[model samples]
Structure formats: structure tokens, C-alpha cells
Target: MTLNLPQLRAFLAVVDAGGFSAAAAELGMSQSAVSHAVASLERELAAPLLIRAHPVRTTALGERVLPHARMALSAVRSVEQIAADATGTMTGTVRLAATPTVCQGLVPGLLRHWREDQPRITVRVFEGDSGEVAAWLEDGTADAAVLIDPPPAAARAFPHADPGIQLATDEYRALLPRDHPLADEPGVDLRDLEDDPLLISPNGCEDRVRTLHRRAGLRFAPTHRVRDLATLIRMVQAGIGVTVLSEVSRSLIPADLVLLPLKPQTSRRLVLTGPQTRPWHPALRTLAESAAGHLAPTTARPAEGRPLPSGTR
Candidate 1:
């Protein structure tokens, strides 16, 4: 039997949100509208796709059918991207999850490039921590995600394509005032900064923040805590204390601070996560390469020294 796309999308939403009411909120429709759509789907399918209970599930019929339903939806979305791509236009929403810096600095360029190339495509970027990114991927919200840390093994994993999952790692640097004693050395070892109040970002800042310290066999004395890179940079400019952060996008670092590499060296793991079986889209593949350029050293040019790629404003 044929089913309408709205009803199928609603059915998927109901399954994802766990109940009709929650699904209604997610869909931005009245409860009655959600109920009506689901009822219509059930009537047409002649099978109950959801069990009406807390932590709902697919009825025996649903368990057998839901998989196919999701595949069908994924296929439909894929076909849409293909058609758009063939026309030299990117269409459909590619929901992306990323840390704030990558979202702020890199994605804009990617989106700009996508728009110039595929004017019809809509890209939605969500910013959050690694945990939030993973959650978005598993629950059918985000089409893709970037993380400064490795995704939990159980989460639906969509590995980064360019460098193959483990993106390039940078030494945990101790940013010191220009004239500080440590600034003269080519690099400062973590052990040398034994008493410095190690500035740390909030737990949600990004997974890379304190990971270097973990590898350096030390714990941070977080006397100063900030939420984003800008603030962390400002704190360093003020000489409040030293901080360790991702130097992946070197251009984004402030000009006022001196970024030095750690003697022992530390690396942060970067990964891209998505549903394991989600049908691949060429746009996504392009995005992965573009993302790597933004994160890894090879593709990125020096700050303000290099112009945006061809076709990007």
C-alpha cells in the first residue's frame, strides 16, 4: 500500500520522539494534528507502527516494518540529493553538528561553497559538545557530526573520511605573554608549568580542551573557566593564565597570544559520527573533505594569508 511522505515522516518522528505528544512538540504541530497524521498512517498501512506505552517501541509489525521504512526514507532523501547534484544544485537539508569554533570558522566557508555550487541546498548547523553531537546522531536528528574526541564505541559512528577518523592532533601549547620566560624556548614542556593555573574551558567547550593534560600526566587547576574559544583567547591576552586548546584551525587563533607547542606533545582525537547505514550523499563526501581542510594543517592556509577556495566568497 502507498503511504504519504508526511505520514511516513510523522511515523518516524513518533518513533524517534517516543510518543505522540512529544512528537507533536518536535514537529511544531498541535497534538491533534500529530495524532491525526499517525492515525492516517496506521489506517493506510493497516498495521500499528508504534506500541502506545512509555518508552514506546515498534509493535511486532513495526519491528519488521520500521527498518524498511527508515531505509525507504533514507533512499528518498538520497535520491533528492542526487537529483539536485545532477542539476548542479544541492537540495535538501543536511543537518550538521559541530563544536562552536568549527561551526563558527570552518562551516561558514563550507556552507558558502555549497551555496555557490548548490544554491537550493539548505544546511543546518547545530553547536554542542561531543556528547550532544553523539546524541544528535543516534536519535535521527543530525545527518552528520564533528567531534574533538572519539565517539563512544556504541554510538552510531560516521568516521571522518579524509584522515580516516583520527584527524591530526596538535601539541598541548602553553600560551604565554610575549616577554614571559617560557616564550624564549622553542617549546615549553607541560612539566615546566607545574604551578601555572591551567585555564580550562567548561566541560562543554570541546573534548580537546583538557585531553592534552590527561596525556601529559597532570591535572589542571582550573582557577579560570570559560565557555568558548574567544573568551579563552581573551583571558590569555589579559595574561590571566595559560590554556590548552586545538590548534587545528590555526587561523582562528588570536594574534595577541603566543601559541607554543608542549615538549612531550599531546594529540586530540577528532571524528565524524553519523548513522552507520545512512545512505551516503556526495555532498556529505565533499563536506568531509572540506571539513578536514578546515581542521587539518595540510588543507588550511595561514591565517588571513590565504584566500577562500575557488567559488567561495
Candidate 2:
């Protein structure tokens, strides 16, 4: 049996774009054409690769095939880049994954800079929760990812990926209603908020918040578990409860809500790294280098406070 690039591209586009119609739009092809390509690929392999559904997902066999497909496509891109390099032009697409917080906070500036500096290279942003983002990098859905306080063991977990570069470290702060009692303070301690209901979002910072509570000898219990940052902010604005979030997330919070530095402040580092199970796409190296220059390693301290100690991994 013979496989081909168009079939593999169609399969990956369908998976990444989440549907044949969307994939066709991204690939600038007819939806039926994309579907036909995927079907042709499945026929060649003699196995169904995708589970046709609303969102479109990979089958068990597809999961096993994803990394190899990504490597193949990336290898082809590398070969294309070689030709482009010889002509003094570099071009390729890089898929970047990040948690919602980083998407809202850091990605905009980075994308803006990349757009100006690397005009030919395209960067696509995929925003998800921490676990989903990590999985995307591991499974080859994303070419690179910005991870929040990634554990040291991640180096071992993603042996094929580059050792991550420290992008930025931002401290966690208290999110409270404007009129709340602690809102008037320059900084609030975990113990100080213990009497009030604690709201927590399980995005990327839940574990860090739990650690903060434990360090302060408080329980990790949260009165409300919110999954979306906007909804969590709305709840805080409505006086439902107070929450703790990173300082970088200030853009997402409204003016009516107050953000105060945490006493004995804690911070989380953000690292940018490539996919774990595939060869680095040619454009990812350039993106990383641009990011390193665009974002200098610095701690995002609160406006009202000095830098605090770093949080545990």
C-alpha cells in the first residue's frame, strides 16, 4: 500500500480544525475534497482513523498514528524550508498551544511581534486548559506550547522536546469584589480570606492555589469550582465569592473587581517548549528565538508590592 502527503495532510487538518468543513476552510479546499482525502487515506491503511462526530475525534488507531503523521508533515515542511532558505526566504506554519490565561495575557504581544518580524511564517494559536495544552504538545497537535510552572520531570516526560525557556514569572493575587473588605488592603493573606468563600478556577493554577493554602495551613477547599475564567470573574464581580489568580490575568478581570498581592507572595513560571513526540517544525526554532527576545525573563510583580518568593513546582 502507498501513502501520500495530501492524505496525511487531510487527516491532520480534519483532526486539528475539528471537522471536515473547518479543515477544508483552513486548507482552502472543498469540504467534500477533504473528506475524500481522509477516506482515501483510511482505505489505504485499511482502518478507520477518525470517529465521525460533531467535534471530530481520533480513533485508538488514529491516536497511535498522529505523532507519526505530524513527523511526516513536519519533515516535508523542513525540506520545503531548505529550499526557501537557499532563496533567502523562510516560511512555515507553527501551531502554538497555551492555557487560557497565557492566551489572554502573553500571546497577543508575542503574536504581534512575530507577525512583524517573521512575515512569511504563520503561527496558529490553540487555547485550552493546562492538561489539554500539554496533551496537544505530546500528541503532536501543537508544534509548541507555553506551559505554566512545568515540573522538572517534564524534561523526562518529553525527552524529544527542547528544554523549555523561561518566558515570564507572574505572581498570584486575590480577586475580590470592589467593595469587599479585603479589597481595600494592599495585600491579603490566605488566612485573611479563609473566613470568606473562596472561588477557584481549575484551569492551570488550581494546584498552585492549593499549595498556597497548604503553605498557609489552610484547607484547599473552594466554595465554588469554576472552569472558565470569564465566568469566574463575573462571579467575583457579583459578590458570589473571592478568588486567587495570577497577576498576568489582570486583563481578564473587570475594573469593578479588585486584585491585591498575596501576602508571602507566590509566583508561577511560564515556559515555552516544542512538541514532545515529533521533530521540531522548522518554524518553531525561529518562533522560540523571537519569543525569547520579545519576552525578557522577568517576574510580574504587583503594582503595589515588591517581588515575592517563587512558588514550589
Candidate 3:
């Protein structure tokens, strides 16, 4: 038997308003209609739901079912609220995930733009490696993400999805000490660093770095490995070893370190991606738009598959 919403609502209104006439007035229905609705509900349930008296009240079974009715009604209203929020006005929380470097270098500026443009929308950011970010998007832990050169395998994981917008293409740069021999060069080639100690982060860029090396007909065996980008930069500053990273990561580099564009111009694409199978929140679209605007003016798109050219920045 179907538990009708209107009947349940009528039953609740009569109890709350204390009488059939009062509930009818509250609900803008006639007293007879309200009484019939309650009676029909009790008949369908095969139980007396309410006592027909001067002051209406629930029977024992009615009391037990009241909470469930309220909850179901509340859920329906919540769905409506979500629809309302999705259509026109932008408000509420927008959760985003991104890699550490993107969060450090690019996300702050995008956040500033959002704060100025849409103060009503609150944004929460989660930082992870590229792999973790992709997983977060796939598993519904995050609403959207800034992913770096997502591979075909990862996209296949989310079939029939939007390929996402390419925010900017960034070439990897060499972080070296001021006195390093390659520090003065306009650009350093990946092959040139074959014998030199290469320091890298174990977080996300390892695979891309290796791919770049392989394309250049060289092997990438990092002599040093660090967990975070800051430490990698510090290691380079201390003259421990040279490290490579994107130009977007310029914000994290120390003042004492030099940034040289890589030779053969290796670079990766930064994409703003969201789930395709699920509804994409409007606030996330707004965030993505702001990111595109912020990145477009200052950063040039790196030629696809080009290695970093030597340059001082």
C-alpha cells in the first residue's frame, strides 16, 4: 500500500492545529477535505491514525509513523532547495581538490578572484598529488579538481566524461644554485642533467619527469627524492642537487634559487576537470571560469611535448 504525502500532511496539520477546522484553515483546504484525507490515510494503513475529537491528536501507531513522515517531507524539501540553488543564485560551499603545486601557485589567485566576484559562494580546497586528486573526483570526495596532464587511463576510469578545459600549459624549469654551471645558461636540456644529481618530489611529478627523460633518449634516475616541493627547492638552494618543476610553481621557489627553462621545452597541461556522470555544481563552473581568466593573461601555453628551454626567470 502506498503512503500518500498529502494524507500524511493532512494528518500532521490536524494534530498541530488542534482541530480539523483549524488544520483546514492552516492548509487552505476545506474542513471536510482535511477530515476525509486523514480518514483515507487511516483506512489505507488499516489503523486508526487520529482520534476525531475537539482537539485532534494522534493514535499510538500515528505517533510511531510521525517522525518518518516528517523526515520524508524534509528530504523532498531539501531536493527542491538544491534545485533552487543550482538554477540562478550562486551560494553555499564548493569543495575543490588540486595538486600541491597548483594549490600553492595558482589556486590562491583564483580564490582571490572568486572572493571579489562572488562573496556568497564559500570554497573549500583539498590538496593532494595528481593521482589522489583524480581518485577524489572519481569517488565523489571532491566536486572538482585541477589535474595535471591527466593520462588516457585515468580518463578511461571516468568514461563519457568531459575532457575538461586546459587552463594553461606550463614547462618545467630547473631550480639550481646561483653558482651552478648551468645557472647562467638560457635553458638546460634534460640530457645535460643525466650525470648531474636530479632531485624530485615523490608526490606526483615523478612519472611525467621520467616520461620526459625517456622521450629525450635518456634515463631518469633521481639521485635524490623528497616528499614536498618546498624541500626540493631547499635542497637545490643548498646546492645539494638540481630539481625541475613547472613555471606555475614559481611562487614556491626561494629568492636565492635560479629558475632556468628546460631545453627541448618539456611541459604539461593543467586542466580544470569535473565529474561527467554527476551534476556539476554551478559554483564550481564559476571557480573554473575565474581560474581560466587568472591564468590566461600571465601564462603562455607551453608547446605540447616540448622540453623546457634554458632561460632565467
Best by TM-score: 2
The alpha-carbon lDDT assigned to residue 144 of candidate 3 equals: 80
In the range 1-313, model 1's lDDT, one tens digit per residue, is 6688778778877887788888887678988888788889888878787888897777888767666777777888767766765676555556788777667655677678767665555677888866787677655567777665543443334332222233334345667767667878888887787687667777643245455556667775578888767887777778778776655545667666677877566555445544554554435554544554555464333212223222222
Q: Against the unseen true structure, what C-alpha lDDT does each candidate score? A: 0.64, 0.81, 0.73
State candidate 3's TM-score. 0.65
TM-score of each prediction: 0.65, 0.85, 0.65
Question: Against the true structure, candidate 3 has what lDDT?
Answer: 0.73
> How well is each residue in 1-313 modelled by candidate 3, as lDDT tens digits?
8778899778877775679998898678999999899989888999998877777777899888776765565455446446755675556556689988999998888788889887877887989887788877765556688787767665467654555656677788877888887778988887887777899888667877887788889877899899888788878888788888889898887778788888766787787766645545545655555554555644532223322111101
| Clash count, candidate 1 | 1
Scored by lDDT, model 2 comes in at: 0.81
Per-residue error (Å), model 3, residue 70: 21
Model 3 — which ten-residue stretch has the worst lDDT?
304-313
For candidate 1, what is the TM-score?
A: 0.65
List runs of model 3 lying over 4 Å from the truth.
1-88, 152-160, 297-313
